[model samples]
Target: MTETTDYFDALATALLKGGMAEPAVSATLADLRGYLTETGTAAHEEFGPAGEFAARLAGGAPAGEPVAEAETWKWTADIYVDRKHLNAYGDQGWEVERIDRLGRFVSRRDPEAAMCWEYRREVTGIKDRTAMTEALAPEGWEVCGQWLYFQYFKRPKAASAGPAAVIETPPEAPGRRLFLSGGYRKQLVATLVAVVLCAALTAYAVGRGANVTAILIGAAVAAPIGGLLGWYAVKRDVLTGAKES
Candidate 1:
């Protein structure tokens, strides 16, 4: 038998063993065949072993009770703390839906039935992100969100761990609304100081009947002064992290 046929035969038996009805099994195999043909890739390569893939599909659709309405939360963190917080919350069964307009993570968890999620952040340019997404999909990751050059991906832990994915004694919810690194805080302070300085200079110039061009020059000079300080703060933090790692 061909590799494709061998894979399907194994997948069909596994799906049936996993409680999929016969009709559904046949339809799934037919769809998979078409997908493999179109992509010019073997079934096992794209979806992994037949037994494991069937288990993932079965796990997502358990037979019995209705699920409770999901509880939702929105929160955000600076780049320094985002991954740490994301994985923490994901372990507690929070699945991030998207990053909203204000750059907050919108997440949900069904109290009655929730799956542990795993997340990772990737830094890449726009053009490479598509390739990155394609590469990750075969491993069951789906894009969670993107902000500037950062990309986030998530997958249920069940995809790899099967029944072991359920969390016991989940961690407490994070109390603080925002997570900013010391470096980010320094940057904010620097930027604020610059803004205040500029405003004071502009006001003082107007009071003394200074020319408009002079005020513009003061503003421009003060703005970059704050920007430079902020840049220095971030650069120092990045360097420190690199050294420690």
Candidate 2:
């Protein structure tokens, strides 16, 4: 048999021995075979030794009977602090399911069977998204969610640290949800001030019997302009912060 076949045989046998069901083992092999073909690299080169790779894969994916319910949590943080929180919660075995419409992270963990997870965020345009995913695929990162021009990827912590990735006991779920950074807080305050000022002006105009049509038209025009300015300001702040560090 060729080296590829030989490598897969060993991997499949290891996965089976590690308590992964047959169907899951087969799917994992198919995916890995496709990856090796696309990258034109040997399985051992791409994934290290077959035994170790199996340990990593099966460590995160231990098979067992389904539970009645799994613990769930949902929370969100600003771009500046999101990564920090993701890593922190992931260490405790929470797996993010998706980013909700409000950009909150919806996550869950099975008390019966749970493994440590890790996450990273990348910023890229739609055009570069394919390349970004392809580059990270070789390392076992899967796209978890995308929002606000940022892409989040996650992987089992076991993929890197082998058996060490096992979490014996997870901590209590965090209570506080919103984790806005100082920058976001400042922007919120500024936005509230602008809103108050606009409301005051509208009230004064109504008291003076100003044209309602004219006031409505003025607001319609200003809304987009204010939004554009806010977008520019946030981008500038991000860029400036990047350069400073």
- Measured against the true structure, the TM-scores of the candidates, in listed sequence, are 0.60, 0.64
Q: Pairs clashing in candidate 2?
A: none
lDDT, candidate 2, equals 0.77
Which residue window of length 10 is worst by lDDT in model 1?
60-69
Q: For residues 1-245, could you state the per-residue lDDT of candidate 1 as single tens digits?
A: 38888989988887777676688679667756765655466788767887777765454333332233345677898877778889888988888866655677867676656779999887768789889999999989988876666789999999788888886654555666677776567667767786787788788888899898878986788678767777666656544442111
Report the Cα lDDT for residue 192, model 1.
Answer: 75
| TM-score of candidate 2 to 2 decimals | 0.64
Give, for candidate 2, the lowest lDDT window spanning 10 residues. Answer: 60-69
Residues 1-245, candidate 2, lDDT per residue (tens digit)? 39889999989988877776788778668756755655466888767888877765554444332222456777998767788889888988888866755677878776666678999888878778779999999999988776766889999999788887787776777888888888788878988888788888988998899998899899889878888898898777554443211
Instruction: Please list the C-alpha lDDT of all candidates, in the order they appear.
Output: 0.73, 0.77
Stretches of candidate 2 off by over 4 Å are: 1-64, 205-216, 236-245
